[model samples]
Target chain A: MKHTLSVLVENKPGVLTRVASLFARRGFNIDSLAVGTTEDPTISRMTIVVSADETALEQITKQLYKLINVLKVQDLDPEEMIDRELVLYKVSAAPERRHEIIEIANVFRAKIVDVGRASLTIEATGTGDKLAAMEDLLRAYGIKELARTGKIALARGSRDA
Target chain B: MKMTGAQAMVRLLQKEGVEVVFGYPGGVVLPLFDALYEAEGIRVILTRHEQGATHAADAYARVTGKPGVVIVTSGPGAANTVTGIANAYMDSVPIVVITGQVATHVLGTDAFQETDITGITIPITKHNYLVDDPADIPSIMAEAFHIASTGRPGPVLIDLPVDVSRGEIDFTYPERVNLPGYKPTVKGHAKQVHQAAALIAKARKPLLYVGGGVLSSNGAKELKELAELMQLPVVTTLMGKGAFPEDHHLFVGMPGMHGGKFTNYAITETDLLLGVGVRFDDRVTGKLATFASKAKVVHVDVDPAEIGKNRPVDVPIVGDARAVISAITAELRKMNAEPRTDAWMHVIDDWRARYPFHYHTSETAIMPQYVVERVRELTKGRPTVFTTEVGQNQMWACQYLRITEPRTWVSSGGLGTMGFGLPAAIGAQLGRPDHLVIDIAGDGSIQMNSQELATAAINKLPVKVVILNNGYLGMVRQWQELFYEHRYSSSTLPQDCPDFVKLAEAYGCFGIRATTPAELDDALVAAFAYDGPAIVDVRVEREENVFPMVAPGGSIDEMLGGIPGGPVSEMLDEELFEEVWE
Candidate 1:
């Protein structure tokens, strides 16, 4: 089981290394981690999707809290969170499939952001499963270009992220 | 006071609280050496070999929990430190290796003795730098120290072009490092802590598979409390030998290859493996797929790369070991403690009685096991520290001695490097002069850097060296004997033994020889009774082999006693006696 956690930490040199090192020493595998500053200027929020079961996630969160610089760690799950992923996908669509591609995009609520005759760019936002399903449906159509905003998340309740 | 870059370097070291540095002098490093002369608080030790200097620095780091600093010249001088840097990298020792390069003008031109040292050392170091500007020296040096000492500590190289070292610049060290990509995660997740607490609350057969990280994090107390609260038996990796008191009932001793049979059994049978500060290295987890086959592993470490490097983890706590363990213990405290059933304990006792750690009795000569046992007896439950070099001697120490405290046994765990014992012993002796410090070394291993005897003598360090002389690379020879039809190639020691007594005397240290058990005991008594450094060379039978031995990649069940299959004479029909004695 993989858990994605958003952590707010002090922007300091060696802090990322310290975080990575903690995972390495503890023998935890971080699947894909995206670190960037949030709305708070002084604090940097890191989105780390770690591949570990529930017990390990708990321990990882507790350890993160112990760091002097880390301010908070939040686990964004489907039940209590609304997750959005922005994907810029370029698909190689033949001139003959242009009408078919537009019809498919309309069904998934995807917008045609770019058009280059042979290539078409689609912008989509949804849950990870939905995005993955869309990709699977479009595989036969061919995807020549693809980019994603690795799952930016927010809690559903009024609690600040 | 404002100073030149060279002076600033020395001033920065002084301010950083570095008391000692080990290095050799050469063309490019002369400026730094000259500045070191005027630098009052910091002292420097000139090593015969650059390799020795780096090893000394590495040993210093291991002992003090601080970054060891080594300074050297350009090109070959910088290249000579490759092995030492690799050694430190392998073992994760905190060391800062500073080397002089050709002047900036001649850097790319391949001047007299210039090399792209930063590039060369990048893969082997935690980080590296090439100082383009002189003013950045103080901050760079401070950052180097910080990087080398924090997180998953390892060697960091700083290749200074001669011009940069000699350039004039103001001196002011940075109070904090601002590395954007170098942030380290230190705390556990609150939800993760709660889940871990829940796991512990429900676990019937819980075991703490502790490793070197426990000692690195100084989290021994937290680990012990968690284990005790959950009533989980603790087994340690080689580097984590003393994280918990070996005398405790919950302690199952060191696990994996060469580990106590009971420890392996405990690991095999556990339902939950709460591994704290361990990487599940190959040596500890013999077969990755079969390791803890029935257990759900909870790995907690500070290094990201080590996670999932071996066994798959059920709970992967990617954070500092100390922080995670402390939180788990705190969370565990709130849960109602459930009493453990004696059924599993009974099975462990049965395994203990069946396959205890016992050696064959040989009346023909002095056994290395006995020697190790004697050392433990001599030290008792005090602050004694034991550092060992590679090969048979290290194995003997691991098997025979009982470490009741953390940070008492420091050796080259990851690298398994020879010549590590002597310098590490010197560093440990210096770090804790009041404690009895000993380095058990093989004849072949000690010779790799025996010149360190002078280091001991010059410093007047009371480090007792117990050299087990078998006249060959014993471990390799044993492998050859077992698997390669006894085709002994370069394993034999050439010619005759050097007069070690004379060698010690030349270095201004006392030396003693022992061939028999009584003689060995007497030599140890004298070495311990003395107030200064001493070397006791114990001559043992050349054919002695460490047993019960497991062939490479072989399971413990296939162990060969002194003789194959049939138990050795002393161990025969002495099950209860074996447990008591071992």
Candidate 2:
């Protein structure tokens, strides 16, 4: 099963490598991961999506705590969390179908982040599903390039405590 | 108040009550070694190899219950400690390894003898530090020892750059260690302890499975108290060999692959298995899905990660084994727990009577088991510690040695590193000079760090090195004979193997070789009587195999050799049990 884990760790050098090496060593594939400074400058929060079972995830969580830098670990409920991924897709836009591509992007609340002579780079930011939907709809126009900032997440206000 | 980082390090060790340290020196570590020279309290032994130094320190920690200390130079010296670190990590031995790194300015530049020692050891060590400032030395040293000796203790590393060591600081050993994130649960949860006690009280066939954690936590007293009070039969893992008194009536035997026939059977037959500090490793629980299938397990350990890593448990208590056991003992007393019905003991006794661990002997050939048994006999009623190299020699030693006390039998259990025994003996002997320390090694493995005979002789620590001299790497040879088509290949030792006796003599230690059973006891006696280190090389049968062995994928019930029905599956059929007992 795929689970999203929010890990808070010290912002010391090599902390990221330590965290990443752990996931790799345990055979847990990180489908998506984003690390950034938390409200406290000394601590960094990592948003990671790992594909593992409940038991393996438990083991991984315990192993993470063993790291001197790691402070806390939490498994976020997909339904009770607000998550987003930012993606930029360069779709080949024919002069005739350019309006159609823009219309689909508009429906998805995406914007044209970049424009080339023959392509429009659509920047989409929302939940994983929303970005995937936009990318699927733009595929008809032929995507020339694509890049994504893997998903980042936080629990909803009910869990703000 | 100003002192160099290296000076502060020596001071901190002195404060920690470190009597001796084992290590090898190189360019980057010259400052630390220089500091040692000026220091008064600590003693240092220079090992021939960095790996040997680390292993020696590791053994020192295992036998003494004090965190072992190692100091070595950077690059090769630092990298060489990796194996020892991992070995200590896997076995949960408390060790603090301080490695000299290239100066901080040249760290990332890959200057001469620069290696990412901390990065390399990150996974293997419980925790590690790369010292950038001399002032942090006291805190880092304090934290390093604290982490290494705390809950689920393991090796911790401190990478001290030469520049940092050269820097001066106002050295003050921290009065208190404050790490918000590093709290170990020393006390058990009352409710869980109650639950475990209830489970045991109701169990008709409760078996206490103990592991290395019991010894590390000093839980052996608590474990024995509970076992005796409840009349719970105990089976130890290889790492748990000395945790429970071998002579105690409640003690059954060590279990798992290469375990005794009755021990494996008893484990298979138990209904309730209270695993204390045991991970139920694959070697201990062969064919996991089938292992203890009917048993409801209650696992108590200090490391929560190890609780369900291999096998699931019904009741999981995450705390120090000693504390948890004490809690359970208290709870059991309140509930008035009773011993299980005597029927189970009858079965265990029958199995013991039918298939005891025994070795055949001859007038001409020295049997390895006989040698171990004799060592146990000679070392009886003495403060003796035994360690062994990996493979057949290790198994035989584990099988035959009588460990009456905790911290008496130390081996490379988890990692099973081959060259561990000899250097480990040096460490063990140094730690307990009044006690007898012996390394029962195989001909193949003793050669790995036999140069450590140099370390032992130079120090004049009277450790005994007993070599079970079979002409082959006996364990692998046994495997090839059983599994493969008997192509021994590289399993065979060279025909012209080094004369261990001559080698020992050259190293300025007592040396003797025994080829017959009559000579085995005399060689051991002479070796033990020697005032200095000695090596007793006993030439055992070339084809002799240590067994009660489970084939790689086979269940514990499916033993391959050593016992009567071993290797012949049909013999283990109901007919054989009935016939053998009759």
For model 2, residues B133-232, the per-residue Cα lDDT tens digits are 8988988899999999999999999999999998999988698886767888888888889899999898867899999999999888889999988888
lDDT per residue, candidate 1, B1-582, as tens digits?
567678888888888788888888899988888899968877687766787788878877766777788999988899988888998887777899989888888878979889888767755788778888898897889888888877877898988888888888866667888664466668977787677778877776678888878877778888888777777778888888888888887887787666766666577667788888787877777756556777887778787556665677777777788899888887877776564624455556666667666765556667777778877787786678888989889988988888887778878888788888887787677666688889988888888888988878887888888888888898888888878889988999841377677778888888988877778778888988888888888776676676656455654334555333321222233454334434
The runs of at least 3 residues in candidate 2 whose Cα sits more than 4 Å from the true structure, single-residue gaps closed, are A94-98, B565-582
What TM-score goes with each of the models?
0.76, 0.96
Q: Judged by DockQ cut-offs, is candidate 1 incorrect, acceptable, medium or high?
A: incorrect
lDDT of candidates 1 onward, in order: 0.78, 0.88
Error of 1 at A23 (Å): 20
**Top-lDDT candidate index:** 2
Tens-digit per-residue lDDT, A32-116, candidate 2: 9999998999888899999998888899899999888889999999999999889989999977888999899899998988777
Each model's DockQ? 0.05, 0.73
Model 2 whole-model lDDT (C-alpha atoms) = 0.88
